[model samples]
Target: MKKPIYRTKDEELAQIFSSKVLPRLRRLEFFGIIMAAIVLLVVILGVLALTVFRFKVPDIKLRAVTIDNYSNLSGTLTRFNLTLREEIVLKNQNFGEFKYDKSEAILSYGGKTIGEEEISSGCIELTYTKLVVVLIEPKFEGLGSNQNLGGGTNSGILTFNSYIKLSGKVNLMMISIKKRTREMNCTLKISLVRQAIQDYYCH
Candidate 1:
């Protein structure tokens, strides 16, 4: 009969580890390292893609302005009230459409808010221009009773400023990108007597 081989507990454990458990542990570690490298590469590519396809802010300009009506009495203008109509053009210079949320157009004079109009949510196509019209009713008060109409008293020229605040997200090929805000400030000069816009500038 063949004699049975007797091995120490330490030797058995070391042989088992070398043949079975060690190989499995090395394979698992290698797999983990490969997976981490792949994940890192994916993240780096995503960042690069986002940087290349980033959205740009649109341009806002005051295209035209008109004073519909003006009322004056006693040969000296008091309560200079009129309807101010402004046309704002938004030009999109981006590669994707700009989706904007509800915004406001405010008209102010002498640090006082005189008029406000709501600009509803809308979208501007890529490389397109959108025209938005806003109507403002402003009543000029505290004009001295002796103020002659258009008599070199500032030439009956009133200066007013407008602000447009818009906030929205950008969409790139059905993928939603980051959110941004656009602010437009404009200065306007109007002739109360002629009821016309003299000069306009926006930034």
Candidate 2:
């Protein structure tokens, strides 16, 4: 047999594999391995989103909203699941897969609650903000007046302020992406006027 290779105590080792210098590979438990993998994946994804993707979200806006079938009731609420359609503009600052699950519209007059409605559930995929419509129900039928939902009714030329709240999640569209994080919904608001229609909502 050839002589075994050996080095002096102070010999310079070109390819030295000293036990102290070797990487310590402990016998990993299943849970530990899984946890490590998840952590590694998260760190990589976070770096990607922060660096290559540079994905981000901005506030949403209600460009144009209209109350349809406003004149159906003859001086009272016509009670037909009244529809309020709106045009929204979303601008995505970063490259990301954005989506929406639930949306809402809250209408308040002069800083008092008027109505809060649930528009719909949907998904939007992209970095750029697009216009989306929300249909909400006041959940109550009433007369030619404004009323705060969960509050009570107030009347016309009233201070009309509205808030749109959203809930959803997003995915990073990349090969390196493994674990996706839940994204909070982007939302916006619009100030509007609700003129007393000749027709109204009556219970």
Candidate 3:
């Protein structure tokens, strides 16, 4: 060439901007986008953990069982009647609220249903305990010569069993996320002398 070319400062700066600054800026933008996507994924996983993956069935227990009434404790016991009262305790240890439907508590003897009662529908708050009362009236029949009855009455003790089941849904974030069922079975021994429940076991 005849002479050396001259470049302006502005041109030099423009060339630097296009070659270095622009690519660096694009890389920063891409990094920001990836970071944003990761954050969004974490939030979604947290929400699922609290509302769906951590769900569990409510805990149910029989707090107490007692005999409210009986017919003629001291007699031939050809035919007898019994009235029982039960205290059911519901414990909720979840982050969501539980709302159950109407259900039943049944009383049985010798694999036979002798009495039953209705339990009203209700709700249990998170980490709270609820108490429900149920009444059962059992009618004894055809026990004139049954060995269990004859032996129990003569020995001054009577045995019975009770069952309860509850079905409901867990409510969280204004949505019913899961459905659960809980149940309890108990065997009780009644002392004729005390005219009350003496011992019991439940599962």
Candidate 4:
């Protein structure tokens, strides 16, 4: 006859711990590692999204145009000169500063250039609007018999067109990047009787 082997209570308890509790603890540790990895990935994606959005290209727009002053509407239409002072609002909607070079605004009547004004170079801060004023002195010449001028003078109104372009770069995080251009074309009408702008729009 063979006798069965016997174990102590402490040994049985140790065996149960190794077989059951050890495996459960290992599974918990693996799940914790996976959860931590997922959380870290989510955080990295979030930071990338924020960085891309913050440093994206800027949007520049011409918000408004106004005729501040006009002169020399009291003489013969073909022999008179008109000096125009116009105000334009340059709006920058971005998280960076825009630095533009010196540019000029051109005035045209009857498809011919008549006057020009120089715009000084400057910087526009993030999410702000800059007001720029330019003065153009238009000389009436070479269009002695244009029917449009005659009609406009008879109706006490004058129509003109203006164009401006600003080329610049965006400064983000103290570094300049991304060359951009902003342009505006405006058609305006001035009432001779009121010496004021009748209508104006820019594109």
For each candidate in the order shown, give its overall lDDT on alpha carbons: 0.78, 0.49, 0.83, 0.75
Q: Provide the TM-score for each candidate, comma-separated.
A: 0.66, 0.44, 0.77, 0.69
| Native-referenced Cα lDDT, model 2 | 0.49
1-203 per-residue lDDT for model 2 (tens digits): 99988877666453354555433433335568989999999999999868657644444665655565543343532222344565666554445556555656675444554467675665455556667666544433343433333122222222235576555555566332222223222222222224332221211
Which prediction has the highest lDDT against the true structure? 3
For TM-score, candidate 1 versus 3, the one ahead is 3
Model 4 has a clash total of 0
Query: Least lDDT summed over 10 consecutive residues: which range in candidate 2?
Result: 150-159
- Tell me each candidate's RMSD, in Å, in order: 9.0, 11.9, 4.2, 5.0
Q: How does residue 66 of candidate 2 score in lDDT?
A: 58
- Between prediction 2 and prediction 3, the one with superior TM-score is 3
Clashing pairs in 1: none
List model 1 lDDT by residue over 1-203, tens digit each: 99999899998989878876898988999999999999999999898677646667777888888888666654544445678899988877666788889988998876667788899999988778899999988644433332433343356777888899877777778776867777999888887677788888888
Give the better candidate number (1 or 2) by lDDT: 1
Q: For all candidates, what are the clash counts?
A: 0, 18, 0, 0
Candidate 4 weakest lDDT stretch, 10 residues: 52-61
How many clashing pairs in candidate 2? 18
What's the residue-level lDDT of 100 in candidate 4? 83
Model 1 local distance difference test score: 0.78
Per-residue C-alpha lDDT of model 4 across residues 67-184, encoded as one tens digit per residue: 4445554464433445677767777666688888899999998788878889999988987778887888776665654334768877878889999888887787788877778778
